[model samples]
Target: MTMSSVEDSTQAPFVAPEIVTVGELLRRDLHIPDYQRPYKWTVRNVAQLIDDVDTFRTYGQYRLGTLILHRDARGNLNIVDGQQRFTTFCLIALYLAKHTSADVPDTSAAALPDVGLEISKANVQDNYTYVSESFGSRRGDLSHWAEFFLDSCEVVVLTVNHIDEAFQMFDSQNTRGRALYPTDLLKAFHIREMSLEHASPQLRLAMVRLWEEIPPESIHQLFSDYLYKIKRWANGQDVPQQGFSSEHVELFKGIKEADPSNEKNRWARPFLYAKNYTDDYTQENSTLIRYGALSGVEYPFQIDHPVLNGETFFLMVRHYYDLGLRCGLFQDDAGAIFDVLPELKPVLDLLDAHRRMPTHQLVRNLFDCLVLYYVDRFGEQSLDRAALMMARYAMAPRVQSKQVRRAMVNNYALGRSSARPPSTNLFQELRLATRPQEILRRVLASPELNGYPELHCLFTTEEGARR
Candidate 1:
């Protein structure tokens, strides 16, 4: 397919951006595309938006961000961006027009008088209750609240004809530093990928629920602790230097979304050449999206992605998110798991020491990787062995030389350039190999050095690790 951009000189000019108050913008039906994430603005976000509009009373018209829209064949305004702001405004208007609370403070709780619109969701009804609490502080006459909101607040309405054009424009906005998180984009990417086939909507919605259940702060930690590093190391790649930074959002590329039954999943070619990704990057200092595409699926760019395809990627993240929460990395104290499992305390201690290091540190990454790997493979009962194996590998005399040390890891099952995980037997061998140093040598000694992170027929340096 031809790669099309909104800025293509041959393309028609976009519909001019219009300065419109909420009144005019609300005059038409608007839709959030299915690929978008649910409205995740917490009460704090809601409070900020409302506080900004409160400025309109002192100042004439408050300029919120742009409202980007694309006209679908059915004439509904498909919000390409700014869904959060647009949805909030609708909720606010509806909140004002509908309910009147006596004891509760929602002066705007009454109802939208004659806007001829309705917005609904199963869970957001409670958030609307929070909206009432927030707006109740304004406590003016309930009657005029919708009118003031519609008339006082304004947004620049940017409408374009093609959805792709709208996305390209939306893409430009996110290339800015402060826009969306990589996880947020991954949420959208998987939602869109799932929609590509006959996947269950109920199942998809369930996944969204699980994702939303994760607190925003924990999402990054889940990636840093397990998903990002484990997946990268599995694919024989290093996690980005930014180490889960927002700029590295190109973590998952969408290559081909054909029916899984009919297709072997292939990674999408990413837009790695995008200027934002390569700004300070140069040849000697850089690792890229294992960068290129095969002949069958043609696309615009390269991305270094995990070997796990879409649904598998999503499921694994969900699994590890739960794991991190259980490991005390997310929910309770970072060391709380050790309290519950006195046995795993030493394992936790070793991993905890590396928790503050950069994720790119091979020792730190592999330690975290093996803990999650062992616990995930053999269950919590195996934590002590997992800890011992990691420490043994770290302090092994073979590791004393920078060469064989890195090489042993490079030669391990994880170091292979494949998305597949290490087999059960390999883990068992690791479990058995973590003995007293002399016995460990006896157990693992051989020219072939079968099945341990032992440095025998392997490449040993960082360059070898990359190889």
Candidate 2:
């Protein structure tokens, strides 16, 4: 459905909510939409649900949770939220019907639908196997438990006629229960934005698949460790002590191309032109550029650029993910540093060998962030010199102080420490520099070289060799 129809539905009156038992809820036809994320609930989640049913069976009617469904024009109930819980419940029902003599209806087991997506299918099989094994062990108690689960467990069913309202309600309701990561909310928001652009269903499904391919933890680290810090530091703001959260999602949500105001937004012209040119070039050159150098042509994306909403946001994420892998930012090994900046091998080796303390780790993170920002802005031009400059700047704070805290790193970056003069925000300098030599030429006050003997030798020796 198009977004206009969904947007208009917000003005319509709300439908009355209904409370239904698990059996009654399962009897109705349910559908899983393509835009929804894959089933991610593990065995622990399944066991918890089973345990909750057993613990609260004698406590009168127990509420399971809420389900927000969209009733389409064809009268199908498309699950907008609670797909994981709903699918798990279906597996439980099927297991009970097979293993117990409980008075469960035949239709409950018949409602189990086949999932098409590979990730969801694998999870479904794994969860079902766990359910079957759990049911087999509790053979004597299965009958009564099945009866209580089918009849006593209830859910608050809030069904809306429009897709947008369903998602809005989903977002509103999810705040209290198992908290969703900020990335999850971004996924949902962009899907809605894509619908507003009238993106084809095939295109939407492809984008979702591309997102699901990345491990969720890697994505979390990408934001928490690198992107979030660089964005805040470059803007001369202190990084949040509590880490990234839902409040900061707007940082990544930029102009929507479909908005009418974009036509008059002069600032958006360069981004839109680049996007259009890339699309046309790739399509036209798909056959001719099969091998060699031309095959790797990609949209020019910078870490500090304005994020285009919907599909481009997803592509930007993929670009950074590949970049992180190539740079070895996610792991302890700095061997990959040679690939881009071979000149930094001695410096990296010194840091890797001697910088093993927890405080040293903070300095390493600072070094990585600087190199990432440099490559993002200036490409490979003068990369070795730039990396050395960043290394010297990031490492000096650790050597100057006996005990380093997070605030010390922040102070060094912003030039607030007593050891350095004020007005030396390194990231801001990198952002404003027009050429590589500008960064290479900038200097910092040297900390006492005797504080760390090996690092001292490396720095002084490198300087001697350069001269």
lDDT of 1 by residue, 6-34 (tens): 23344454688898878667666666654
Error of 1 at 101 (Å): 18
Residues 103-160 of candidate 2 have per-residue lDDT tens digits of 6655443322222367776877899899988888889888888888989999989888
What TM-score would candidate 1 get against the native?
A: 0.56
How accurate locally, in lDDT, is each candidate? 0.52, 0.75
- Indicate the worst ten consecutive residues by lDDT in candidate 2: 1-10
lDDT of 1: 0.52
Q: For model 1, give the 10-residue run with minimal summed lDDT.
A: 110-119
Candidate with top TM-score is 2
Q: In model 1, which runs have C-alpha deviations exceeding 4 angstroms?
A: 1-16, 33-36, 56-58, 70-75, 98-148, 159-171, 196-207, 231-241, 254-309, 323-328, 333-346, 349-366, 373-383, 391-467
